[model samples]
Target: MGGQPPAEPASEEYTVDQLAAKVGMTVRNVRAYAGRGLIPPPRLVGRTGYYGPDHVARLTLVRELLGKGYTLSAVERMMSELPDGALALGVFETLVSPWTPAEPEVITEQQLADRAGIPHDPATIAKLIELGIAERVDDGRLRIPNPDLLRTGLEVIKLGVPLDAIFEMLPKLFEQADQVAKIYVELFRNTVWRQFADAGLPAEGWPEIQRTLENIIPLAGQALVAAFRESMGREIETAAYEELGLPPDEFSSTG
Candidate 1:
């Protein structure tokens, strides 16, 4: 009765290994943090210990504080001053974290030529750099932000389209895409996100927000491609009819 009370075990939990993997830390480090009281003690059941969400949130906060040059003792003190669950929900600590851009792949000019199966030209590479497709590093390697887009550009170049022309078109294309993005975002802001804001921004509804955004990605892509294809088809049909010395209306009805 005089001794310290037994710890209350958490119901929903993860094993030590699972907790370590989830927090991107080593098992040894997780155990050490638990030992140092930086993380809460794990739930014990028949000699097996398990950690819960609180431990995960604490470990994340501890790692972040340590990265900022705070000592373990200092971090402990700082964490103690915060109320429960305050440090848990970070801006990125959601079911779906913010999308991380792909890392640029570093390749030699020869490697890039091999990948795209195109001739290597210094002038072309320069144009790509100017167009923001390729970046030249100090070490003489090219960084391709997107290999697929670069391949598409190279195909157009092979089709007798000048690199200068392609570069000139990029800004106008990107400007239109940006305007489309703004329109879609405004639609969401006026509808889905507006509802979230009106409901006082409950934490439980964040996953629904993430789902809506994810659903929108493919819908936007399909919509854009469909419209482009329909417009291109109409233009090609008109051009073909004109080349054959026929009126555009005849081919238009046939199409």
Candidate 2:
């Protein structure tokens, strides 16, 4: 027998009885563990069952850990935790709807002013076109390019801030929103993908998680909008009238 190689074992599927014997546990206890989800049950094809190496390893660990005084509840809880985003950028990117642009069309400068419900003036419309906030169409007409920008600008104009002062801040806002969006994507990949998976969340479990993100995003966004509306409304009112509180003669009509 010296220098002779040992015989290779034949591949054979293990039955529940054989698996239980291999694990050194009773058949009833093995079945119970499977039912309680301490282990996944064996694959079955028409009443014949087979266990794989993964099952044996997991069962061995479960038995060893339980013997060392670990409770099933503690083990299950440790196995189930999934951590998510801590980044502020994730707030807007994942949850909120993106600004989907509508098709472009031609409209007169008078029409843009009309849409804002303000008196039409060549000076202001020309300013908007010059600043690229309004686009001048081929037919010598103008269109308000972005609705959100148009909306914010209309309010700022109403408050009597000059167009140049307001539009200067816009480029910075846009660049920052884009930068934050990139971070948001990384946050989704890291916290939701890498961290949970590192903690042992099966990728097969994602349907529940997708449903949960859908549920959570709206609630958080709604609460934030509600809180800001209340806080900003009063601050806006008080700021607008800081001059009205002073003597009428002492205050200049334009600041």
Candidate 3:
């Protein structure tokens, strides 16, 4: 009996044009990066070249670094230093991505109004955009980047809260949220990140850094929610006591 040959492993390969589209870059930029040796040379068969996953990862990293204000030379220098640039990119993405990812939903103006229980008017749509609740797409339809947030806002409105009052509160709420975020970011920067930097950001440390980041995200969210609940309860109880014209301790005796 003869032994059977093994099957070839499947791999993704892309032409230059396909690669450009896949990474949301132009063909010229892809060629330019290749010319600058920013990415590895593609596999060539006769006159044509085909790219694989590493090309895609490198191009994506280049674009991300440039978007984050890195100069071309700086990007080149950083890419040269990293032993596994792709792994670093994965860590970078995890660090910067939203803690709770949400799928964006596109809807017509009428649908938005119906879902939100608000008027289907230009002013209302503008307000929604202003509040970052919705964004106007190229086709003039609205996209809700965070549908969960919109749903939560709608729930608040259903509790007899005026839409205008909610809108008025959002800016302050966002400001406080930003402050909370900064506090956590600064803590990480001063501690974990500082240590990583001091250790020269070794290639072996990326996995641990990513794990720390993953752990911190949920922990930070839980802490924020717990703190807010405690603060909200205290304020509500104080307000209730004042409304009833009683001292804070008098409630226990009355009950």
Q: Model-by-model lDDT, in order?
A: 0.74, 0.62, 0.84
Could you give candidate 3's per-residue lDDT for residues 129-151 as a string of tens digits? 99898999999898998888888
Clashes (candidate 3): 0
> Residue 98's C-alpha lDDT in candidate 1?
36
Tell me, what's the RMSD of every candidate? Answer: 7.6, 18.5, 5.7
Candidate that would win on TM-score:
3
- Candidate 1 stretches with Cα past 4 Å from truth are 5-103, 114-119, 241-245, 252-254
What lDDT tens digits, residue by residue, belong to model 2 across residues 63-135?
A: 6556648898774553234222122122223343333345444677777777666788888777777767788
**Could you estimate the TM-score for every candidate?**
0.62, 0.38, 0.77
Provide the global lDDT of candidate 3 against the true structure: 0.84
Q: How would you encode candidate 1's per-residue C-alpha lDDT over 1-255 as one tens digit per residue? A: 547666556665889998899989999998988887777677786578888887787888788778758898897776654434333335224322333336568899888776656678788778778878899999999998877677777788778786678888988987998898788779878999889879876767766776677677668778989999998888888789879888876654535
148 Cα displacement, candidate 1 (Å): 2.3
lDDT of 2: 0.62
Clashes per model (N, Cα, C within 3 A): 0, 0, 0
Better of 1 and 2 by TM-score: 1
Error of 2 at 41 (Å): 35
